[model samples]
Target: MPRIDRRSFLTSGLAAAAIWRPLGSARAENFRTDPFSLGVGSGSPKADSVVLWTRLILDDASAATSADPFAPVPKQVAGPIDVEWMVAEDEAFSKPVRSGLYRAVPEFAHSLHVEVKGLQPGRWYFYRFRSGNAQSPIGRTRTAPEGVDGFRFAFASCQQYEQGFYSAYGDMAKKDLDLVVHLGDYIYERTYGAGLVRRHGAGVPSMLYEFRDRYALYKSDPELQAAHAAFPWLAAWDDHEVTNNYATDRAPDAPNPAEFLARRRAAYQAWFEHMPVHPDLAAGFDALRIFGHHRFGSLLGLTLLDTRQYRSPQLETSASDDRPERTMLGPAQEEWLARTLGASQAKWNIIAQQTLLSERDTRAGPATGYNLDGWDGYRAARSRLLDAVQISKAANPIVIGGDLHAFYAADVKRDFSDEKAAPIATEFVGGSITSDSPSEASLAAALAENPHLRFASDKHGYAIMRLNDRSAEVDFIGVADRKQRNSPASVFQSFAVSDGIAGVNRL
Candidate 1:
């Protein structure tokens, strides 16, 4: 067996041996038993435990094929894989916290996900896995704090695999954040734009048939992999993860309803495979992964939303009447969010979502029509979410987003129509990892037009958010340029969302 010698590889051998138990009593030679594995990971952190994951890449891992190529067709197993996981306080493993074994079965694509529990909160720990005599690489993770004292987190989104470079990830990785919030559009299905302005390798998998292939292509990116290995991530997806501008029962330019639904299920399954997500919560056919809240003790409660799964189709006529029945997060999820926000006891309530919650009607170009695909298209739903924010009066409601490929800060209001509408929340929009740079001239024009927009930038990068008892500062770090393969980044703009005020002022 050969090892890739890359920093990401786990181990050169598998530890502990188990008797061979071939499928249906098949011979051991037929099944895969690759000793040199790809490696391991951890995610979905609770105060006491976290989920550790890994995939046993077989020597003859099946190649992409016509009908669901990534699907693992059963081959006779060489033997049962003895998998062991360990969590320790230090990288040297002097003080081990937990150690255990799990069987690596072919049914799960030879991957292992162990939810390790019984640990102290607000502490950093190192973890890894082992099989037979082989051991995996050491990964660092942290447990959430129990109360609000001081905390720092970075939020990002819109990482198109083939756009240009992952300078954004590199920038975010250096910030030393406690956790990362990926709002949505983690990967784009459609080759996205085209030409130089926007171009990916190929269209992403719309169905399960190509989900694994797409994820493999994405995971292969060194920057993305580095960022993942560097910290624990809380992620969600937007329309591009499955299809462009996709809404429930509707796909961009997609005609057939049944075929589109099948594609959605496939994409969702693939997303689960590649991401550090839990299996129990994966989206199934007709079932949507919508709104959910994560409570970080009494410090912060982060709410992740799925706007694409239940949104009403963007209106063609664009009338106020279209607002009555339309929604971004269907009535049920909307209610859940309201109750969750109103019920939250945390000092900071963060909404991690796909698009700008602020009214972005003043975007630079021709007032040609708003991206009906975004909140601008579902005015009523946006209003509903904002109304909840007002009613709940969350300690400090902050909406973080990443879809438009630009950084923006706006004071969310009860009414976009009322020039004097009371402020309900604060919004911080992040730019993309390697997407097109919206024209600067347009941004300047839009800035001049929209009074609520305190800050806006067309640069490509991510935001570093630090929250303390006093204020939450957001640094709009911008990269040198994404056209090059390796570009360094710097802070272009910075703003702070005051602790008690619903406003963002330049820092």
Candidate 2:
């Protein structure tokens, strides 16, 4: 755990308190008459406490006044100037554990992230947010475990808003999951082109101009909102948040530095504003620290990494010697992860990331190589990551990834060079929410040649993981169809990793 800078936090708290006051009797009366339009959310939970979030959607920003927000005004105003949140031990708000007032700034898209601390561990809690007359639908969340037996959580990635419906989320939300791990590419940056798999509406933003608009468009979706309200989410972003295939300091597939820093700042700001991240970490362009570990008691330790921030350029050259000095998790983050995994007391260590780590020399078959933007281009760094897991000898360090728009389960080997390099880890890769799959007969034939790859599917769906003391079971859930919102879901595949196993086994 990171050391708490009490002095700095206190100083910041004082500064915030100076401008913001607690919601009292008078303020509560002023905010009691609106509809629960936007819904509720929770995230960044510790063993004892968790963050509860809500937003007060206004008819318009200016109508919410000292008087009546709903009164017939010539123009609309931001509703519920102040929002209050409460977390309780019971679903009925019978015993209040933590409560507070948060300013629902229109600048922040009328949203608030309130992190409540110092509660009991391993407990389920119900929370809600209110703005004037309108109360958001109540939400449920859980805290981290103080000890471990075994735990379960689902992992997913590459959700393009235009490409498909969010039926996968709808299904996962209903599952008995401890939490949801969103690896990256939660939303796409591209607008609709002709005959695209998923198509975005007009006015979708790409550059800094469309950042706010893009977020609003996405948040309007009921499925996404419901999923947010359903469970605590741990998320990171890939290139689509800003631009497809964007690297740390470069534009899409471009070598020039360009205005990458400015773009990154904008994208980060938009992400923080829309997500349920704590205020302390909401400094947006000021700081970047998403990589962290989550411990479920002594059972499992989950490390969520940011792959785009510090990675080197994806090499386009075919020669092995021409690979760039690339890094998926950067030097510092990689070191931190290795140390964290090595020191973990948990039974399982899971690395949640944005892309696949398995080696696929696509050249041997009808294909050339894996996407340069994925782990294939960063082979050396990926090798080192696997080596870290191997060296740490952590019990069943399962790796979950999403990016290739396909489901893949593989044995993580120390070296692709040796046929018998001991399997160090198991990887489960989920497909896209609604993206197109590669359609090559040669590639279809290539699957038969790959021995290490246990399973691969180019279908659209999500993965559900159930953890127990003896093993972790995962189900690859397939969507009925990607084009329809009311699509059904079915289990397409299942795999498990035992306590002592280094690779996945089919069920």
Candidate 3:
């Protein structure tokens, strides 16, 4: 057998044995607590397959936390451990459907990425993992359909570990949502936000182990854990996953390219280990592929984007900002999006990217201010994407995002400055899960200045979108009080987009 590199092994498939490790080195050690402390999750659901994930965190391994010295460490695994996984028609595993063995090795952080294939289309299944005497929590996952049918999913972003509680996930889990799309900021790299009901329990991480520790801290939250066990999440990241306000190869905080790319490599690898995404996504930092498309029956087509990975530096708000060369998704991703969006045949097309797709004028009076980190900074790039939306003629193309930390529903105008220009598509920007939102004064100005924006909220929450052949309805579900452990999630606002229409109606 040929020896495959780690990246090559992952890209080829979830063959843990291909990495070449001595199975005899693996030993049986009974764990007092659940070794699967990180919880189980599934993602990348296709009509016949879905990727399942879980990480083995032995109680005696090593210190995964630096901020909290008292935190317990994990037990080290000397060799490969075969984790038995089973999928069934019932949660009890009485009617087992698929069974497999995943070789877990410490080289990949003892994380298992099993791509279970041959599942029935448009159906739900229960799955669990077992290794010796230890067992993982049962997780629920579903496959996409091959025909026209209604699909329901929720998307949220900006979950800073130190700023607020994860009651949003707790509340969202009770909603019985079919799918969850996290648009970025899954973990905060900084600790500067105010009103800390919880802390990251560690310092800023720049190394592989440090980043892994940061992820371990977030995964310890029971609410977050329950949410992951409830539904498979399509996860993406913005700046906070690495550092604040970073744009591609340019790190404003770290001027040296070598230093920042090293940190970026660590962050990228950690994200792959924690997320239940495709095996190819963990190839490497240089060729990591997190951007892709997922379809739900034939009613909706979702395009997951990686805007932060290959964007140019945030330019100053001046006439020079309109440079035609400025790119957000980069040339390759832009071309891919154009080709993919142009060919989409779903009843409702959803462009799932980080940050608001529509323009927002922040300054109250004559002075104009735009978030250079968003689409406003790259005018020509936004125009080209809008052109693709126009040319593709996707019916009721709706953009959903969550980097702004506020709720917004607007008509995506070809030209934000022009009112008479009919809307080419609609957008719903969900508020942050627990991260702080823009102040009322700032949001008030944003709403008043941007006439295209129909609704705005400063609450912390996510967006639940229901799609069908006739129309698509989006409910902005907000957490009543994230500071409270038992925060209630309610529909802050609702809107609808008729089939083939280019505008939204407030519901």
Candidate 4:
């Protein structure tokens, strides 16, 4: 492994030496096929750096003709390919800031990850990629601000291709957001429903090639590509990215530990290759960890959590399952969260994670039933986390989550069962981008039993949050129909949480 210098990675004028041309290369010639079919994306923005990503696709004929639109098309050339990336202040390549040549190798599916640094903070920049004579679509991304009065961003999750079209992303792409947080379920591992709006390539993905094909299929969507190209994204994964209801080295459906680990490794590799995450964070399959913190000047501190990667195996919901020994974030990440929250000086400290943190009894009776996959399963762990927030006196702690396929607004309390317990943190769980959800009546019945839950909606859409020094305003937006490609989205509900307040006020 080579050391990466932050300053030289972008400013170093080494493109001439690093650029690798193909055999019998001339000046340039237009080919009969296109290679930039997957499009370009940028993400994991920092104060002075951002990661740009794109994959080479030689044949996209299958994407246009196959009934299963996401089917992976075989590459025309299979070897090391030279890719050039450039970041400029303007849409045109007039004021170029960073330019570099990267070799997209076959082992990594001919994908290029250019970690361009030495950028101005709190500024938007345009970037594009070049391969021979082909040019990729221009993408816009912004670097995080060093200090600012306020910021606006959106958080979304659960985009199942077969369930519905990615219409929500079309709306999200139009939003004037500074950042986008994706709280898991980016891709569904298993295929579902026949004769649907769209279809997955084939069966469930368990190998490296299968996982890579799945990601390529999902990323090939125009709507998804638009959202990624529009802004830098901060993403984390839940079970569906690999398999449903999987925990630390355990797959509930496939109980074999060795087989599940292999599948997880493949899934993790594919995720890293496709996502626009920084190279340093891109670890091997066995050591993959996506939990980290991002600070938006002094206004907000976002802690992205990884709930699925290092959790205890899911057990039957019972009193014993709530023991302190069971962990959702694992011991190390829990401590890291505590330390990060304690040291954070931002006005708002947000936990951008997966699933609902508040306990919701789904049985609709006193006989309690919990989704062992959520924070409800690790009751003691959730309690400890809340306790840490209170003890540290964290500034205006807020929790944003997804993966329940429904929108929920709730107050996190010391004891969810105790009606008198004061709220310690405000939690808002956004709905899926395109996945199906339970009916409104079904969610309403569940809310009747769970008083802590203030608002509930079984619609498909995303959430937009505006944070400032005084308060954080959240609008839970919903689409009218998921089956329709051009479904209209409207604000289903709105809530405001004042600075230092632990509960949300309905607007």
Clash pairs, model 3 backbone: 58-75, 60-74, 60-75, 61-74, 61-75, 61-76, 67-202
Alpha-carbon RMSD, each predicted model:
5.5, 7.3, 7.2, 6.5
Worst 10 residues of 2 by lDDT: 1-10
Better-scoring candidate (lDDT), 1 or 3: 3
TM-score of each: 0.86, 0.87, 0.91, 0.90
- Candidate 1, residue 9: the lDDT equals 30
Which candidate ranks first by TM-score, i.e. highest?
3
lDDT of 1 by residue, 1-507 (tens): 011123333332221222211123322232234342334456676678777766655554442232575767655343456566778787666678887776766544555667788988878887766554345556677777787577777778777766677877766655676787788877777565543433445555665646655666566565665566666778788877788877887876679978888888777766665566665654354575645787777878888888888888877744446546778888888889999988998888898888888776654445544666678788877877888887887799998998889998888877765767656788899988777757887677767766677788888888888888778888888889776766898988888877788777887
- TM for candidate 2 is 0.87
Instruction: Encode model 3's per-residue lDDT on 240-292: one tens digit a residue.
Output: 89998899877768889789999999899888889998877666775477899
lDDT of 4 at 447: 89
Candidate 1 lDDT trough over 10 residues, lowest sum: 13-22
Cα deviation of 1, candidate 3, in Å: 46
Give the TM-score ranking, best first. Answer: 3, 4, 2, 1
Which lDDT tens digits does candidate 2 get at residues 44-105?
77897787766554544444453765576433344446666778766656777787777766
Which stretches of model 4 miss by more than 4 angstroms?
1-32, 60-76, 193-195
Q: Roughly what TM-score does model 1 have, to 2 decimal places?
A: 0.86
lDDT of 1 at 233: 72
State the C-alpha lDDT per candidate.
0.71, 0.72, 0.83, 0.83
